[model samples]
Target: MSILKLKPSCKDYLWGGSRLIKEYGKEYEGEVLAETWELSCHPDGPSVIRNGAYAGKTLPEYISGEGRQVLGTHCRRFRDFPILTKFIDARDNLSIQVHPDNRYALKNEGQYGKTEMWYVMDAGKDAFLYYGFQREITKEEFAQRIREDTLLEVLNAVPVQKGDVLFIESGTIHAIGKDILIAEIQQNSNVTYRVYDYGRVGKDGKKRDLHIEKALAVTNRIPIVRKNSSYPHAADCDYFTVDKLNLDGRVMQKLSGKVSEESFASILILDGEGTISDEREELAYHKGDSFFLSAGSGTYTIEGSCDALVTTIREKAAQVRIGIDIGGADTRIGLVDVHQKLIAWKTVRTNAMRPAKEVIQEIGQTALSLLEEQGIAMEQCVGAGIGVPGTVDRKNGVVRYSNNIKWEDVDIAKEMGACLPIPIYIANDADCAALGEAAAGAGRGCEDVILFTLGTGVGGGVILDGSIYEGSGISGSELGHMVIVENGEPCTCGRRGCLEAYVSVPALIREALAAAGKELTPEEIFAAAKEDPVVKEVVDTYIRRLGTGIVNAVNIFRPRLVILGGRISEQGDVLIKPLEEQLRQGCFGGEKSGIPEIRTAVLGSHAGMIGAASLI
Candidate 1:
């Protein structure tokens, strides 16, 4: 395919200026041209393909027809189209607003959260915009200021000029001042929580409604340290990376770049006119032109006497993170790319008899072997996330002790780092599973969730605000040890009637066998319950005990959801259906508070591996 030129969709927002139409040559008959979506696949305003056999189709249609692989491997990380580009001409000050990060946005808005960067094209003298807070304020103080119409007093307003760059992370409070034209690159989400709209009435003659509560919940109420961010790129974020390209039509007549299969190239013309061509074909380019060159389109040459922003998703290998789940019996290692896809993996036995040094050495060697087998270079890896079954001193990347693997005071990160030149981060294995579930599995969009791994022993992780919250900065969240009964059955941790004693797979198996006067695996126990009354009682009691623990967790954390993982959870609806009933009846607030959505984890054993890889 040749270079795909895009015809932008126009927006006539209330705060729009006509600069886009008059100065930028955007053809729109409306009285005000607020923004031009030069590169977008959003249903609200998709860019139309302007040239080629698919000229009449919208960008989404083209992607649908050409297949998603045309977007390249890096884009696969996103659930939908990864980017949206726009030219905004702010005639009036935008509302003081904030945006939710990915977890919050996906749950509430059904889209990715917006993290945007702005490259100033033009700005009138004395123009200024709010960046964040001038100083940290209490939640009560913030609320009081907003209610008193004094919120702007605490906001940090900075003057702007042409060529200034500002990266607006999703939760940062910001507003664009009047008389400024900007080129914006952002995630595809369009959720904006307007905090303070300057009491301006819209064209409909009504004050814009304020999402003060949601804004307060998501806003970062601290002063942001401003920087130009010269990090070897124009802008860099989890979602996108951008570079500035300029040509004078004088000394530099042509610029060249290679479009590898790992990522496609998106070029937006800011000024001047020139032609962009490759091995496939050549196309004319001018200001306002947006071009999409498919990945692996090799040896692209831009004979452009123009200024442009060249954006591309970094290659998949470059972002691949390794997740290593160290189990007593066997260890699972997975290579997850930028999109959290486990593209390559390996399984090796845990040589528990070996010294800690040798075990760590093997883990590192196996990782390199997997990379070699998959044809990935070490330079392509971001780093590794290791999930060990133990208490860890995360501050120093030390494994204080692991009962499962019988290791103590091991600097696993250093051992692995020696074998592999990349950074090695270690965390509790159960925590890794929770993070994996939250990142890409059943818990993907939820912000706060509890993952119960119902394995040999019921270990789990607590994810709050997209992070593992370890209380007191060291030891806490030993969810399995929470006692549900007094002086009942002894637990592996020497506690009587703890949640793990009643709910873990081993405990269930022992009790089921004793009840039925016969042996059975968890799978067989569930199978026997259907026809045997004794086994049926065992299943019922197991569900009730597990429900007790779920109720306790829900009431304490009030998380949006709960995920059941590890071995016993794979029984599917057989175990979950009854547990849900128990939770419905046991939760404190009844129907008003609503029980969290409880679901079996989809990632299974790989959760530890994938979660570990994503820690970076």
Candidate 2:
């Protein structure tokens, strides 16, 4: 695929605290309003439309398949093909605001709400960003503070630095400080509820409307903040995997094999200039350029000058286990007795392939039948839980994108509930596994836990204080999509050098095949690690990369534990010992520091199924 160049789209606002120009004339004030690029949805922001006869149309029209053939897939799925990338130059502090997820939006605004991230381009000395409340404040307290105009006292302000990336999950009260530039990536939704804006006036000399009720409704009491951090550099999951490569001078990066049984990838050039080459083509890239590569593209190479950061997003490996009769054909439902002591199970069913109406009907019938056989009635089911393999508006149960299932904008929960009459909870499967591990598996009893699944690809789940943390729209836990290696391997998510591209099952297989000049299953390669020095070397390299990736997670999350699951976890000691050692040696925290404990997942194969079921 050819590279797509995204143009700069800016916003000029007379926001009370803007960075406009100085006075130019007696009647005109050259004050700099907040100059912004609206990458996603912001009611007051600009939208990016495809160039052509319908060029002036909004992004929603393009995503809804109004005209262009190239955008039909995007419109149907509502995937995160970031439309309007922006450069925000804040002159004064913005408002302290939070966004609702799709669920909140459906319940109130009747649309999907935006969830965004900011990459700091520049900041003044002592400049800070508003993140969460200073401490855990109750909903009532937060409401009262906003009502009393004392909310500023409770906000947590973090010092800012250039190159710092902040992941603002939905519902976290945050704002940008003065003299800063940021690149924002978000959901294609335009609903924001401001709790406070420093009591500033607009160009019209009026305060903006405050959505106190709505803001309080969605604001998270316990907001997490990680400072002075970079990308994960390596991680995985079904949706996307990321790797952060800090390159200086020249570097050679290669990616081969597969991350999942089936998947694709993309590359995002965050900095510097570089070229990616495959057997068929060579492409040059500069800062902010992105490209997509098919999963079937096999091995490839990237050689670049100066320093470049690349991120690869791809599919996670399929989890496996033996089992007897469970249920459903598409569900991949099965139960296997383990060691006559344990039972492992998995279920991978989706309605993405069928018509939306049919998918809803099929899921409803199957769920009802499954529940009834288990002596549980539909009414007693509490809520139906689903694990999608792609980007999802979890709050509203909308499957935004799923290449594996070929689904887009399907309200699986709402539609199914219409027929089944039950509350429904949905999330990414990897996130489900993370929550499962936290609730009843290896991370049991821990307040904070980060679960990593090593399979064909990698997936992550974050649990805090016994509750799964779903960001705005329930689209938060995308650990695998963090960039690690600059201009490294290609990923499925249309980025390059993501974690999945490096240490995933397919990546390991690729390395092994490259060394032995023959293809081998991940299992066969592991078995050979004991006898073949070459295989051991390859396995060691993977463990080292995996360890570095874990270090990144540790630095960012500071969890109480890091649990590993999925098929690759079957390698056991071969993967764990080295991983633990490397993490200990390479991480930022010293021994006895608040660094998290790293362990193998005890839930094994049933993790996903149990996690999926627990989502209820």
Question: Can you write out model 1's per-residue Cα lDDT over 1-616, one digit (the tens) per residue?
Answer: 7479888999988899898787678879997988999999989999998888898899899888987788777665544677899999999999999999764564466555688999888899989888999999989998999999999999999999988889999889999999898999998878999988878998899998999988888888888998856678888766678999988989988999988887778899888898998877889887878898877777889885988898888744356778899999899988998788999888999978889899888888788778878987544666788988879987678999888889999998888876664567888989889989998999998879899989889888889998886887655488898999989799988779899999998898999979988888999999999999999999999989888998898899888889999889999888788878888898889779978889999998889998887677
Local error of candidate 1 at 369, Å? 33
Q: How accurate is candidate 2 locally (lDDT)?
A: 0.61
**Native-structure RMSD, model 2:** 22.2
Clashes of 2: 61
lDDT tens digits, residue span 92-167, model 2: 6777889885556744665455556676766899899898878899988988888898888888888888877776
Pairs clashing within candidate 1:
77-339, 322-613, 323-613
RMSD of each: 20.5, 22.2
- Strongest candidate by lDDT: 1
The window of 10 residues in a row where model 2 has the poorest summed lDDT is 319-328
TM-score of each: 0.56, 0.45
